[model samples]
Target: MRVKCTVSYDGTGFSGFQIQPGQRTVQGEIERGLKKLHKGQEVKVFASGRTDAGVHAIGQVLHFDTEIYIPESRWPNALNSLLPEDVAIQAAAFIEEDFHARYHVRAKEYRYKVSRSEVRDVFSRNYAYHYPYKLDYVKMREAIKFLIGTHDFTSFCSAKTDKEDRIRTLYDIEFYEEDDVLTFRFVGDGFLYNMVRILVGTLINAGRGVLDPYRIPDILKARDRSLCGKTAPGSGLYLWKVYYDN
Candidate 1:
């Protein structure tokens, strides 16, 4: 049966979601649990996308084929028993044979969190980026206006990325503040390597008065990585949600 599962992880303890030899990865653990369930027979799990080290996720989706015949409702409980504390299966269901967690995704939402308080919260350190610098909220909002819609986001992606077709349709970049915390949510068809984090960093730079908001258009047109700002820390990033056409 084709099984679809939504998993959540703290990410602090994980190297990343992919299977890396000799590394403690989220996929490694999940595959380990699956093997345990299958009496040592290895099973592979496919994720929607890979998140870098220290990146968290609340609704990361994945799929794998299994023949254990466990009910969909009990999949979570069965997997949770074999998984580590940092990772947990939130929900699972038997999906169509053609349903793919990655290729079938129509859209995805990624969120980055920032704490602007002078006093740091130790508890949130592992989950949020502590950036107490003064940010012009109005400027950040204005900068994103240039980001919404389809365009080549080469400047907002890591140079290490090999994907040449950087054109992505950004549905929206939403910003909101709650007291001392700033939340930036990005909705889009897809993202390049570190694209959302780089975009957030560029927007934050605009808010910090280092870059002019109006220059965003030129930056996009430039297609130059040098025009981009610092890449935000991975801790602040989260795979918020994934949407499907079906």
Candidate 2:
């Protein structure tokens, strides 16, 4: 049977989602649990995408094939018993064998938080990016408008990306602030490696008056990674959700 699972994890204690040889990784841990459950047989798990080190997830999705049959409702508890405290199985169900967690994805949502308070919140230091400097939220919102819709996001992606096609569609970009915490919610068909972080960093530049909001269009047209701002820290990023066409 093919089992689809939704999971959440605190990326602080993990190297990343993918399995690394020696480093402690989310995939390695989960697979290890599955191996124990399967009586030493290897169970390969596939995820929707990879999260970089220090990135968290509220609704990450993955799927794996298993020979053992268990009630869908009890799968969580059974897996949780074997998994570590930082990683969790939120939900699990039997999915069609043809369904794919990665290829069948319809959209993804990523949320980034910034701490705007002058005095750093020690508790949230590991969860949010602390930028005490004042930001012109108005200019940042204006810059985001240029980034909406379909476009080649080469300038917003990492130079290490191997994907040749850089075209992607942004369904929406939501910016809001409450109690001095700034939130950026992005929904898109897909994202390139480090694309969202690079965009956030550039938007910060716009907020800082270092780059004019009107220049966003020019930057996109340039297709030059050097023209973009620095990539935001992975700690501030979260994989909020993954959508499927079900």
Candidate 3:
């Protein structure tokens, strides 16, 4: 049977989502619990995408196959018992045999949080990026508008990325500010490695008045990695949501 699950995790203590030999990872933990469920039989969990190290997730989706019969409603409780405290199975359902977690995705939303307060938020140190510098939010919003359609995102992707085709469709980019917290949400059909982080870094540069908002188009047209700004910390990023059609 193919089982679909929605997962949430605090990525502070994890190496990353994918399995890395000699490292403790979210996939490793989930697979461990799944093996216990199958009485030591191994199972592989396929996620929609990999979140870089230190990136949290509010709604991550994955699917796995198993021969054991466990009620879908009880998957969370059963799996949570075996998994570590930081990782959790939020929801689960039986899916069609051919349903795929990665290829079937329609779009994904990623959120980056920045604390604008001058005071250090010790409690939120592991959760958000602290940027006390005065930000020109108005200019940042204007810059984001230039990235709201299909384009080659090579400038924003990491140099270490293995992806060959950099073309991607960005559905929208929105910014919100309340109190001392500034947030940005990016919705796209798919993302290349470190794409969202690099995009946010460039936008933040615009906010800091280091880069002109209108120059974003030229950067995109350049298609050069050097044209992008510094990449944002993974701690400030979250896998906000994964969308799929029923």
Compared with the true structure, what per-residue lDDT tens digits does model 3 show for residues 46-138?
A: 999998899999999999998878898998998999999999999999999999999999999999999888997887798899988888888
Tens-place lDDT per residue, model 2, 1-246, is: 999999999999999999998898999999999999999999999999999999999999999999999999999999999999999999999999999999999999999999899999897788889998978989998998999999999999999999999999999998888887899999999999999999889989999999998988888899889999999999899999999999
Q: Please, what is the whole-model Cα lDDT of each candidate in the order they appear? A: 0.93, 0.94, 0.93
Indicate whether candidate 1 or candidate 2 has the larger lDDT: 2
Q: Count the backbone clashes (under 3 Å) in each candidate.
A: 0, 0, 0
**Residue pairs of candidate 2 with colliding backbone atoms:** none
lDDT of 1 at 59: 94
Per-residue lDDT tens digits for candidate 1, residues 203-225, read 98999999999999999999988
Native-to-model Cα distance after best TM-score fit, residue 111 in candidate 3, in Å: 0.5
lDDT of 3: 0.93
Model 3 superposed RMSD (Cα): 0.9
Off by over 4 Å in 1: none
Name the runs in model 2 displaced over 4 angstroms.
none
- In candidate 2 the C-alpha lDDT for residue 20 amounts to 92
